[model samples]
Target: MTTPSTAGSLRSRAAESPVDCDVVVAGAGPAGLMLAGELRAGGASVIVLERLTEINPLLKAGTLNRPNIEAFYRRGLLPVLRQAQQETEWTVSYISSRRSDGTSTLPRFSGHFAAIMLSEELLDESDPDLAGLNPPDMVDLVHQKQVEAILADRAAGLGAEVRRGVEVTGFEQDAEGVTVTTGKGPIRCGWLVGCDGGRSTVRKLAGFDFPGTAPEITGYHGVADITGVQDLGVGWHATDTGVYLNDPPRGRITTVAFDGAPAGHDTPATAEDLQAAIRHVTGADATVTGITSLTRFTDNTRQATTYRQGRVLLAGDAAHVHPPFGGQGLNLSVGDAMNLGWKLAATVRGTAPDGLLDTYTAERHPLGAWVLNWTRAQIAVMRPEPHARALREVVADLARTVDGATYFAKKISGISQRYDLSGDNPLVGASAPDYELADGSRLADHMHDGRALLLDPTGARHDLVAPYRDRMRTITTAPLTDDAPAAMFIRPDGYVAWAGEPGRDSLDEALRTWLGAPVAYPSQTPDVVAAQR
Candidate 1:
């Protein structure tokens, strides 16, 4: 908990510290801040409580997937994610594969969906550090602090109160609302959102159970602004010793294997140890300018069985913790907020029932599990044993030759992973591409505001959406004219809410699931008006 006046914002002093809001977000990290943004976008009254004196300088989650980018665009978040960049250059560092025998260098791939989706070209590993992602949104070069501050500003702009240095000590909640006890003291609110970190005080006070296995093996990772050391590709550089680098061309970020590190302890990781490991992996002593940030974490893959308990609920790390192998923590946190904020806002705004909040945990908990399972498999394949290497080789060869790199690529990039329930089509619950509309327009252009968008066929009835204009944005079907194109059925989070041919029945069904009811587009042509009548 920090004092209000000094948490790097004099702007707070100009305005009164809010005692309460509809939603109170603890922890000013990306997760907390992004949740705040989503709540604000949905017109929810929000208050963000951060104990930090300032924002974090480290760039934590290094990448965001295509699905995430699409989500951002649909939700009107790409502007914030990209800021000023026109295009972003994603880095494709080194890759490694190990089985029972020995470790060998595997081919590198870009986290940028364009390279993976359009070209299959692996860029230099250091691309994202200097440039941004494709379209400059998902893979922008904003530090954790910068992104946090950006969201904080957005929250404030959207009428949400953001209080820094106000440490949230605890909370008391009932059927109605919540009263939060902060370092700044007690404040009352209609709802409290615990966006606090893995060791959340809010979760503890609420007695929310974080049910999952804590990894016996831990991993240590550090980021240093170093000079020298070229591309290692993007993947693990496994020794019988155990190491996996989020490797970049300029300076790869390497981590000790889960088995390599001591169990249960998150401490004892230092610059000296990281540099030594770097030396071993690169086979050279590179220039170590300084450590931007360092963290030693036990891989704990856990999620609260329920995200909400009464008026108080949890989001981000407060609700779940898993290995960072997928770079999903930040995205997952945003997803949590994206899932919950709108639903919570609708409830608060008197449009939806409180029961909708339960779906937040339902949708996201399993997504985290998939990431957990995949990372575990990746860790197993990287194990430094002859037996493990042999087992991995047989599968890896089969996957590549048979299943192909595209499948492997999708898995690693999170493109292949779909949700538990995708409405009717498999593509519905999956990520939507930055596709072209039927009219040769970009899907993003139609998502001017944060609303569910339906990509209707050129002649399909747009009148169906016109009725729910406030809740839905409708676009005409168009073929891909350029590299970037419009897509069909965009959830607020930018996932393909629905796919295939868009019709009256299909569009209405999608609206019901995503927006809670039937929606109508604003543009009502004379023909559409006649048809409705």
Candidate 2:
């Protein structure tokens, strides 16, 4: 609802009013913390309010997909992420369980869809989706708790104030700013972002429209001390009743039953409940001796009609919710944060182009919708009925092939996601490939500062971009590949905004489109020499 007039008025009012921070973020989950760091990197002050006093230790995503990994890598978080991965007992045990020769009894996993496993070995190397991925593109097995910890530390290190045990109860937004009501007190900010989970209070108080389908399946995921189920081998198993996954090293198990959604979504499922669900799915007399932690989930697909309304915005699960079939939730949420953080920061700093903030929804809503349908399709493939079994067989066969596995891998890992940006270059809207520059540093190496970059191999386009040097960085680096563009503009979030071949390159429109009109120098000539000064 932030029309041009309202937006202009809001900016005017925001400047007149004093605020606690540039942005106030609800929820300290991975999405919120990631966004806090991103905002700080863009030189925006941030305050993160969390309802929980301590980090939730419940088992969640055990892997970071390609896009998720890349997001951290661009922020220079990969090393600490790897260190945290090594510290996790589950990761250590899982790694040690494999054969000392670095092989496992199970096949090498690329990813899965509806519990249908895909082997990394069967992936098509020639697949465009797999091309140009640097070493960091490989999926990393890091616990969600570790991810939260890493991001929380990073955000705090970057000067974002993260207040725990503070919950956002209500909020009011206007042209000027937002007043957020919380348990501790009230806070005023230029912008408000709800990285809160699916049931977001900010979205509700702000009256954002969220519409989507209902849940038909109840899923249980947890870690427990289980016994009397040695026959229930590790990995996904599809039985007549439902599907169950047993991973002994991780002491984690998941059961998907089409027995309607759980009545209580917030309460943790009991050990007996998990035992019963496991028995129902696996047809084994599994006994849950004790539960370390447990949670209930469902395939309830929902999405906010729009991610923004005036100064209040939504991201992560606040914007969309779907089944966790492919472990896509964490990746999807992080992607939302990565997309919104820089744009919101730019708006706070008064450097964003007109409609640039709105593009957050325009670019990410389709991906949210795509993920909703993606999880729904998995539900269809996972139905316990006979017809679904037939479909599963066909899907399983397809998944075992190189092309099919690669296709699913591309989607599940989120490498195929591209913003519908306008440009003739094929790579324009996609995540920029980690191109090796002439100096040997990868493209990701220069993105730690979270500024837009113009990679000019010819070094001839500096004059065109010098005026916007504060908002964008110009790098004189040649690509190692012949097919690479003559010059490329990469957004802060690592997406290719524009690219052109030799002699065909033009950056004026792209720069203006993304970075807003250049800061007017004292000189206005096309060849303003002071631009470099």
Using TM-score as the measure, the top candidate is: 2
Note each model's CA RMSD in angstroms.
9.7, 3.5
Please identify model 1 stretches exceeding 4 Å from their true place: 1-19, 77-108, 111-146, 225-235, 244-249, 257-269, 275-290, 395-402, 420-427, 432-435, 438-440, 456-467, 476-490, 496-533
Per-residue lDDT of candidate 1, residues 65-93 (tens digit):
65555556665566666652222223222
Per-residue lDDT tens digits for candidate 2, residues 1-533, read 33333556666766688789989999999899999999999889999999999889988888887788888998888789878877877667556556754445655786789998889899888876677554543327888888999999999999999999999998887767889999889999988999999999988888888898899998899889998788886899888888988888778899999989887777767888898898888888888888887888998999999999888899999999998888889999999999999888888777777889999999999999999999999999999999999999999999988889988988888888899999899999988888776666777877787888877756776567777877777677666788788888899999999988644335788888888767667763333121121
Query: What C-alpha lDDT do the candidate models reach, one value each?
Result: 0.61, 0.84
Which regions of candidate 2 are displaced past 4 Å?
Answer: 1-12, 93-106, 132-139, 502-505, 522-533
Candidate 1 lDDT score at position 410: 57
Model 1's lDDT to the true fold? 0.61
Candidate 2 lowest-lDDT run of ten: 524-533
